[model samples]
Target: MNTLLKIREFDAHGGPSNVKMGGDGHAQTSTTVGRFVIKSIEKHVSYGKYAAWSGIAWGTDIRIDGGVVMVKFNGSWKKLTDVNAQWGKYKNDQKGVADAVLKYQRTLYPDSPIPTKWLFNDFGHVSVKYFKDINKDRKMNGKEYIMGDFIHTTPTDEAATASRKIFQLAESHGCIHVKPNDIDTMIGNGYLKKGNTIEVHPYTKKAIDASHKRDTAKLPFEVHFYPGIYKIAIYKSI
Candidate 1:
């Protein structure tokens, strides 16, 4: 099946009285791509945050396939929901997933203008690669290959220690999961970064000894993927 995955999201916006008309209401916008639907709307309050109180316009929830690369909204699903505590958390997490998916997709396919269409053209599926650290050049199967930034490294966090954690996270839930061969292309073309540390295990917060250095002799290490759901994508040959 020529399938794509799109995630739905919700967000909120509030500010001072830009408009003091006879009435006040929130403006929400919805979007769709193909069979997939995603909508983002703003909820404005009748009174400012400092005001006694204000009425809220509840947001809607749309379901998107986990495997979809694009979304197509039909303007058919719009419902008012009661404002709740969990809404904020859900909105934040959903947006994170959406943003991460887009960022990773763009990094992987920079030349393609039509992201969804290009992804749908039987280009391939996602593959997860496990590594000891960001600097380590070994693939999961004991082969040497370059690695991409599976997860964004937090500035405060140390890269030399988070490579493994990134690999594991990528293996578990990477959208456009990649394989070792594809990773080779990234390495050959210098798309992969050269220096950084990788976390070995997220659960334990342990780290491997390898650090990113061009000279292999300068840094010596051995690592493996450990065999898991590493990379998730649709392959043309497969």
Candidate 2:
């Protein structure tokens, strides 16, 4: 029984290129008026015939499962190959196959190619992992706490304009908490009949100025005059 083996004619760093297999011997049988030519195969042939001439107990009928077969190198399997005939329609495309291979290589063989997937099974350990736990402190001072409800609701553009106008009037007067009805009449131009809550603050002026600066002065510079309505609150600032 001939011992057939698959031998890589290509180097470990390279692929199968212009290389040939070893061993040979030819035969020529004579008949009545003709001759037949034959060749004796060896134990190892080119990578091209790896799956074709497997000499297992099943003779040369030994079959190799189709797909990328991992080839060994220095006690480890790091690379794969497939028979051209069996490669089917998977020869080439733009599906990032080579990129996937390179990614695998970097994962499994971070340091040296000598230690491949078989040796470095835990590829994840070689990579860097980062985690962060953030804790935020939500605390406000007397002024911010008291003025928090001043413009509490999301207002439409027109309502926001009214809110800003009313806030500006109160800020210019330098007082906090005006009569809700008075503010309604003053800023709402008598449109606001129901009295709710109103507050004025110098800090609001600063906030408005900062916001206006941030918007490159596209926003109104003065304090908000007819600020939008807010839920009533009894809070007061020092």
Candidate 3:
């Protein structure tokens, strides 16, 4: 059995659409988009809060605002106690750090690409990292180490501090943020697993139109397998 994870993202300015998952050509389950965000800062320089990447190249960098790529679930899921717990461990507090970084960005470059308001909380409960390179070869040479991470979304204290409301249009630096309950349901059924491919799609008219046009032919993120394992695909609509 082959599993496909199809994600169709709607326009970032609007609400999230539906996400579908299944094996073969059949649909298993669908979920509504609670809330998600994309990269607001677009630059190549590394800011303390925001990871730096070349804006020239779309998918080659960390900013995945409007792009598509296939990545595998790197490992198992780990449930964190709370947003504070994640901040203490990973030191990825977007609010505090991004604010300081944005201040510095303003001083260094008055016309900085960094957004005015930034707010991001940990996935809340369970989270997983996805990567393009399974092996550590690229990492050893100092190449793109981790592709991106996925986390279950839950309302938290950290989320409240930001000027923007959580789950509305709250943007991420690059990571894929999802609703906690939705992911919990999927994990409960053992649908998501190590080595499962996650296809990230941008919520753009061009990409959506192209996908619709190529509905019949083999699509960009469509997967094929010999058999035995379950194939899951997540399609997100705008």
Candidate 4:
């Protein structure tokens, strides 16, 4: 019953440059996902304002039972020590650009599970959803919007310690926070289930110039940290 599931999103208004967060708080914006689908997979509940600021707003607050799945948008909570101090300062001041972003996240996830820190706030063990729902009535300036309208992706409240020095990552008020074993290996290798069809947008200047020519033809060591201090002194003289 191919309900249509060609999901291929790659947003980066502020996040997703392979996650090292610092600017794109609230999981950044811009979402459409063609027409949205994935109706349900429930059990990791905690809707709206993260269940009124962690007040137990529902059942199963997240432990991966059924591993949350209610796509519509309304989930986000960042602060796992500020995403491990921004990838632990890029693995302590860029250890070869954090080992080439962990070798491009293990060559784009080669069987998942490599997260020691940077869990984007742990996400209650993981399996959140949401990458669509354009604007199902969750009005903005029109008044009548209280983190509702759908854009969720639960899990990641790891007991909310609440620190703030300018921290503002929590904003799944349009959910997309994932990690629970990489959504259980994309729903056990099925590429996500429940009437699939996700496609969130943003990043199209010819897909950012073909992702800068596939990260410079295969992460030339994270493209030598993208030319800054003379390309980090020519990547420390090769």
Which candidate leads the pack in lDDT?
3
Candidate 1 lDDT score at position 11: 15
Model 1 Cα lDDT, one tens digit per residue, 42-72:
2222233212111222122223344222232
lDDT of 3 at 52: 22
What tens digits encode model 3's per-residue C-alpha lDDT throughout 91-172? Answer: 4444554454355435434453453322222333445444444342322223433333343342332233222334532333
Give the per-residue lDDT digits (tens) of candidate 4, residues 43-131.
Answer: 43343333322222222222211221111123554221123333234433434444443453354344443433232222243332433
lDDT of 2 by residue, 29-106 (tens): 111111111111112222332222111111111111233333343344422323233222344531343344344444
* Per-candidate TM-score against the hidden true structure: 0.17, 0.14, 0.32, 0.21
lDDT agreement of model 1 with the native: 0.25
Distance from true location, Cα of 138 in model 2, Å:
67
Kindly give the stretch of ten consecutive residues in candidate 3 with the minimal lDDT sum: 223-232
Off by over 4 Å in 3: 1-121, 134-144, 157-169, 203-238
Clashes of each: 36, 14, 22, 19
Greater-TM-score candidate between 3 and 4:
3
List where candidate 4 sits over 4 angstroms from the true fold: 1-27, 30-34, 39-124, 128-170, 176-193, 196-238
lDDT for model 4, on a 0 to 1 scale?
0.30
Question: TM-score of model 3 relative to the true fold?
Answer: 0.32
Total clashes, candidate 4?
19
> Mind sharing the TM-score for model 4?
0.21
**Which one is best on TM-score?**
3
